[model samples]
Target: MWRNTELVRGLTLSLALLLAACAGAPQRSADPQQAESPRPAATQAAPPELPKSSSESPGAEPALAETPMHADGLEPSADTAANGSSPPMDFWAGLRSELQFTRCADEDTQSRHWTKRYAGYPQRFQQTIEQIAPLMQYVAAELRAADLPVDFVFLPIVESTYFPHRSRGERPAGIWQLMPQTARGYGAPMKPQYDGRLDYAQATHAAITLLTHLRVQFNDDWKLVNMAFNAGEYRVKNALKGSKGSRLPEPRGLSPITIEHYAKLRSLGCLIDQPERFNLQLPIIDDTRALASVELPEAWPIEFLAHLLVIDPQELKKLNPGLFGTHTPGFPGYRLMVPARAKDDLIAGLAPLPTAVSARWQRVALADPEQQRTLVLQSGLEWDLFTSINRQGGERVWLPTGTGVPKPVALSEPAGETYRVRQGDTLWHIAKRYRLRVQQLVDWNGLGKRALIKPGQWLRLRAPE
Candidate 1:
């Protein structure tokens, strides 16, 4: 019994030693490279990082108390609050922080028209927010990406109330509310069928660029910049010459125009601060997956293209507000904002559409080419289109002379033509004149996008493929 006990004790002792050795053993590295290059303990043991809080991150929102309660008491879904994880750059919250145009102070009814009325501002705000949901995010993104204040985003609301392609029978148009000259300066094409000023994506970029320039020029004083934007920099600077350098002490000495602009912006800012406090059930405005911008070589009918892309036609129209009508003009490398969900489908469908199915061409008939006649173009219908098609003209035809049309013709063009570049001409003007696409001009001339064609420059006008 003593011998058996001794043997058992020895076996137990050996097992204990083996277990302790196993517990203390250094593990081998799974990666051979890691084994050769020993990493520091901190590096190997570091945990995956969690997302930072608002206070810790750039492009983040201020605390909830500093701003109005976002999402209007509801939890966030696809709805965007100014600077959250939502789509379009957390528009409201972001703009709220960037606001220097006004203080959310009490009634200055004498100077501000918005304050005199009922709570129409919130209602209008809600309406516009809802109206511009899918598109708003894109514009907001541009502002944020440019590092411009969210306050400038609201200027569009003041200007056009978030409606793209809105014209006030005045000079300015589009969501950013840029004037024709400003729009042209910022690369907004003034084509008859399609105005780039109405283009949400293009106009947003241009607007941000213009605003950034104004901000830089005015030494980052947004109020003065906005005032300048509304009532021209020249006028704003002229008004400031009477001031204490870029800032007015009070409403006492400012021009009426500057004051009104300041007052209107401030009024809107005040109302926007506490929309929920006023009982407005504003939606969360984020829609990150709303629209995707696709580059196009030529024009395509919005409805038809949407159908081809397997998306909602109206949704495409809303995304592409600057198309002005049924089709986007065939400009060279035109950016088409389509439904984000349909991007893959659109790209897949764009593999050289058939001649019968090509959106570029439309049927037009010659009504006895002997009489003086003309074609008042619809949207996307280029005047230079005649050179691309088989024209059987035996008589002189004057444009804008009431060219009566009620005939069916083949879509195929028998030949092409050319034109000399004249002063005060553009690809849009040339394309409009020749009824050919800007893309066609680019392809034929082998020019870059929006390349400068000097006076007396030879350009193809529907000259054969």
Candidate 2:
């Protein structure tokens, strides 16, 4: 049985990786603090009371390490308490009351929705939860420190299902589901060298910043803040105008919005109205006393740390999904959150990031004359990997074997060329098809919005030069 389970797990990971490879990769945001000088690794010792793995079921609703609930808080009214006993109303009421709850500890009594929604595929959900629960603890601590509602930690679960590489409509990316504009607004640089949205630490800071801003804008209303996160501030503002005193939004605008937006906001409001539906509770996670930090050397890979520490790479990856790629990108250094007592040993065990620069036989080319640099193709390297690394430095560098870069294919003098936009086509796609970048596409077509391309539009591929 154990061997079978291990086989299943391996197959699952392999499938996930295969799917990822087939899908077009999304853009990532960069860490803001990465450009600063690297910081030395933390020298503190690990905490003595690190929670034992065997104590709690892996991926079970995260066991809160510390209670943040204060007794002075207002008690729920009889009406609220009465509602809490109802199946639909109970779970959410518990959340609103800031009490802790989970799926009925009895596996049999667990609601079908809860089982299907959260626990049906125990292996997959458990794996995701185990990886994400630690980070959730970190997020919860940060929010609680600010006196904000702790349920904000659930946003990532809904957004990415704890998958750091998940992407949605357009190029909105990362666990927090940030679009490029919003990511940039939250201080994420959308450049090749860095993408802050994928940097877990930086993105968490940005998520908190955005959440705080939304909370303030909504007058500390958690429900409205959640709505804002789902549908954008403008849509939420419109919804607020429509939902006067009722707990639910009228069924009117539901059609106009995307199902994801509609479903998420409705689910959020439902949780507000009747928390028991989701078996949610505000958890106690204030165990900062037992927390310690592990700092990484610049560009250190978590996989290497995992190998050095004799821990599973997946374990380290789960703990630090924000690292992105196989290694830390563009960041000068990063801090890893761990149980407080384990800090010293972790730091002591870490090996310095390798910097052996070998001039292996590789093809080279001049990509940009302005930078006075050329792209090199290292032998035996994957073409996509090579291109991705070079693109990180900006300007087209190298193409895969059998995909030679077309040398500035110039358009003939002043002829109107009609181009039909296909499905999944964007200005960026059109630019690439014409061996140009987004800027060139916009300039050629006189388009004001870089993201506004649609299927079937006839575009003039070339302008009078």
Candidate 3:
């Protein structure tokens, strides 16, 4: 919920206004052939909203269109294919084996610019690779799963330097640097408790879907799809229509920044393919070290789960960056990203939590005989007295004196001893497990209707002493 603060709202409003102003503002352009000026390195803040003339707004790029997957999915070239039928042992090796667009001509100025950036500082370059090894593995796996060209794996370096939590002050956020509008358009949940864009799994899936849609829209031209991603889809479409032949014209109606983005992806792909040419060694990303997604049976507080898994909560938080608070949201069937090494521990840790069973509660009011008959008919209660009692806010009833009273009955008397609350326990969960109503748990434990339970606390399963 912290991600949805007033500050984020205010910043979002300001961004909307800024885009509106930039749309009508005149922009300067030069020949695309000349050397385009580079922004600060990928490590710095960037990809600001540039002015649009014929071009579409940067962060306001349209949501992913519902383009069907091509008849034949994009495939890796022979050179990029892994040896034999066995899976590649290394994550980076698997990606490299599937690369289809790592080549750039020797004389291409755009690609050359990034070649220098990669070669400028050998140490920093290697450090960057090491830092993003796990993230890269995840992206690579997702692309492979979707049968997308592995070349797209480098797009994040151009967008967010593979930092999941990176934000441009309410501009595109997440590893994919997805605009809020685009993220929402794709239906990647963006609740107060969770920003799906910041979640690696959610962000990667949404971006890949967009990329796939673009590939189909542009007739499988990866280059044009990359441009569409940076510039708006309509801008690229217009450029294609305006050009003389099938191929986009030089510049392709792209501004300097969009061109740079295209170059960055091509350059990064090329450099990874031939790092030896620049006297650089690419780091091996261990498949064992990558984060793995585990679908949680129920919501769990991060701190308590971390303790059970013998991991630091912050480290766990890094893997699932979207959650805004101590606990994951109560969305059913939520998936959590945890350390690959700790998957077994996580399963074991969750084994102790009570499995939920189906239960339903009916509301009824206490009233005098004649009123009760009318109430029974209206509310579907039998003639029998309710087994347990609790108050639901302001429902009409009648007292012996014929004075109007308001109360509700909770079914089933509480009957168990206190159970020590576990990490993922909720009142709804505990009540369902014991076949007791949630309201009864609240009344028995003296907990407020909205009280949140914590691990290690004692909760009364039956009526409290």
Candidate 4:
């Protein structure tokens, strides 16, 4: 009985020890697949990084604020800084980064359609791009500063093909293709003397203003905004109101023209987004701001301004197409778009120059029997200034046998006296006659390379002292 009792005690003690050992040991899971295998502390996984929202992300297309135009007319707004990403390398890349609508699968298909069409005529496409490179740079900078979608730069692309002075008979004008009433409503200078629709700077501002207003009216739906931009806003509003059963208006609700315009916007945007997809490389346009607006105290002849700035007169005309005829109107605060490099020089020239007095012009009848004869001035100057002042550069200018020609009646005197150029006089001959270098004569009068001396035109014998 004593031995059995001791054996039972030992057995009980061993059983208790075994149970404790089992309790302290890590238990194996019933299903090995379902086991919770903990990794080392250092090897633990981290939470995934979240993508940024559109508003917070750099290069995201945000709602544009309705800001006033720059205090200096025609100045490009500074670029918005990129946060947490590398900066864009060029203008097209910068523009592509901000594209939103053209990124999706549905939009990609639509945009790619246009890309294929444009790619068909690669040379024409390339020429058009080269032609509008500077304008595109300026417009892109302006759109970016306005906080507008960089895709808005393509508006001009689809509008007038970036023809700033596109003259269509009584239709919407300028690069933005603004209607006359719409242009005037938006405060674009729409006078008979100066058509602001032809002025890129004014038209861009007006178009941006109109677009902003439309965006608000359309509940920020760019598709509808673009539709309204093409067709009248009333048309879009009417379509939306009539579509009682549908959440959005059907494509059939809009006219084919408006629909096409919207498609064009999308397609052009898509082309810009994925040029490579269309088997074409994107053109490399410099991202630099290439244009500046200069407010002139007085209207200066674009020719004179071009000569002073040493730029092509045709380029100056192209930039300031709003100016009537060959000169800017004689009004205060007349603005001129000049190359950025020439802006400071123009401002400097304006500061030191004395206000020019209006010259008294008189009409003198020509006694030439030939109907197409070039009129000579009595002072031995050619009638070049007269024809220029009168804006007579057509192939055939018809004047009666005794038609009147305009000439300046008075001279300011002094400045080493003016010499009257004879019918056969040349710059070389005149320079030798005055004992002056040909360059001096050319410099004093702002003479061009031709140094064309017209019979009866006056020339300064000496430099202004």
lDDT of each: 0.47, 0.40, 0.52, 0.50
- The regions of model 2 sitting more than 4 angstroms off are 1-131, 168-170, 187-195, 241-319, 322-327, 330-341, 344-465
Looking at model 4, report the run of 10 residues with the lowest lDDT sum. Answer: 1-10
Off by over 4 Å in 4: 1-89, 104-109, 165-169, 243-252, 286-289, 296-298, 330-335, 351-465
Candidate with more favorable, higher TM-score: 2 or 3: 3
- For 1-465, candidate 3 gives per-residue lDDT tens digits of 001110110000000001110111121123211112222111231122121242343333311111110011011223322322333346656666677776644227866766665566555455456546666777787788888898888887766555453343334566676666666555345765577787777778778878877788887877777777766576666666643556545435556656666766777777677666786666544445566666664555565566556677756666676776656654544567776778887786556433331011223364555765675455343343221111122354311121112222222223225655654345654453343567887898888756788867887766745
- How are the candidates ranked when ordered by TM-score, highest leading? 3, 4, 1, 2
Q: Compute the lDDT for candidate 2.
A: 0.40
TM-score of each: 0.50, 0.41, 0.56, 0.54
* Clash counts for the predictions, in order: 24, 27, 1, 10
lDDT of 3 at 390: 18
- CA displacement after TM-score superposition, residue 81 of candidate 3 (Å): 29
Error of 2 at 35 (Å): 29
Model 3 residue 227 distance off true place after TM-score fit, in angstroms: 1.2
Model 1, 1-465: lDDT tens per residue? 000000000000000000000001122223211111111010010011221221221112111000011121112333344333223335566666666556466437732455333244444345435544555556656677888766555565545444442332324556565665566666566665567777777777667767877888788877777766655555455555633465554223434433544555566566556555555554565444466678775655565566556557655655565654556766654678766667777776655343223454333345653321234243232445433222334343222222222122222222224555544445654452243456778888888975788867877654444
Q: Measured by TM-score, how close is model 1 to the native structure? A: 0.50
Which candidate, 1 or 3, has the higher lDDT? 3
Show pairs that collide, candidate 3: 80-97
